[model samples]
Target: MYYTDRGIEELEGRRGEEEVSFAWLSDRLRTFTDLNPEFETAVDRLATWLARLDDDEDE
Candidate 1:
């Protein structure tokens, strides 16, 4: 559930050509969800942050 397009690209770059694995994502999701039960809400916030980063990179 990567948010922004660029952020997804960055993640892919780091992970290489392989598709993101469920195990990898599950671990991260578990961490975030444990911290806050509203996982979807947190992801929306993350998307906004990534959008800002993309805008900043353009400037």
Candidate 2:
């Protein structure tokens, strides 16, 4: 029911079956940040979290 859910659903509907490289995804994130500077912090947090998914520091 959240506002972002719609975007998430649209993304799933549009590209759920597609496979992309990390580099491509990074570029896309960069482009999105460039276009939406306000969301840069959120994007940076997301990227950092994703990059550390395998780290064992926190459970």
Candidate 3:
């Protein structure tokens, strides 16, 4: 499997670390595995979102 069970569990843990809802995490996770063709887009979006939030908090 491209994403092993352990990988999925690890992904869940990473998702929790984000402090966001499971639904949002799940949606974003679609980018990590083989679930979506737009994986890169999802990753870029999350990166941008987190960077913006971090910047705002630092201001």
Top-scoring candidate (TM-score): 2
Candidate 1: tens digits of C-alpha lDDT, residues 1-59: 54678877897798777676657766776687778886767765765675578687688
User: Which stretches of candidate 1 lie above 4 Å from their native place?
Assistant: 1-3, 18-21, 34-39, 42-59
What tens-digit string does per-residue lDDT give for candidate 3 at 1-59? 56567877887887757667657765656646456655668666866686578687777
Judge candidate 2 against the unseen true structure and give its global Cα lDDT, from 0 to 1. 0.97
Alpha carbon lDDT of residue 40, candidate 2?
100
Q: Where in model 2 is the C-alpha error above 4 Å?
A: 57-59
CA-lDDT, candidates in order: 0.71, 0.97, 0.67
In angstroms, the error of model 3 at 32 is 5.9
User: How far in Å is the alpha carbon of 34 misplaced in model 2?
Assistant: 0.8
RMSD of 3: 10.8
Candidate 2, residues 1-59, lDDT tens digits: the string is: 99999999999999999999999999999999999999999999999999999887776
Q: Estimate each model's TM-score.
A: 0.38, 0.87, 0.32
| Weakest ten-residue segment in model 2 by summed lDDT | 50-59
Which residues of candidate 3, in runs, are more than 4 Å off? 1-37, 55-59
lDDT: worst 10-residue window of model 1: 42-51
Task: Sort by TM-score, best first.
Answer: 2, 1, 3
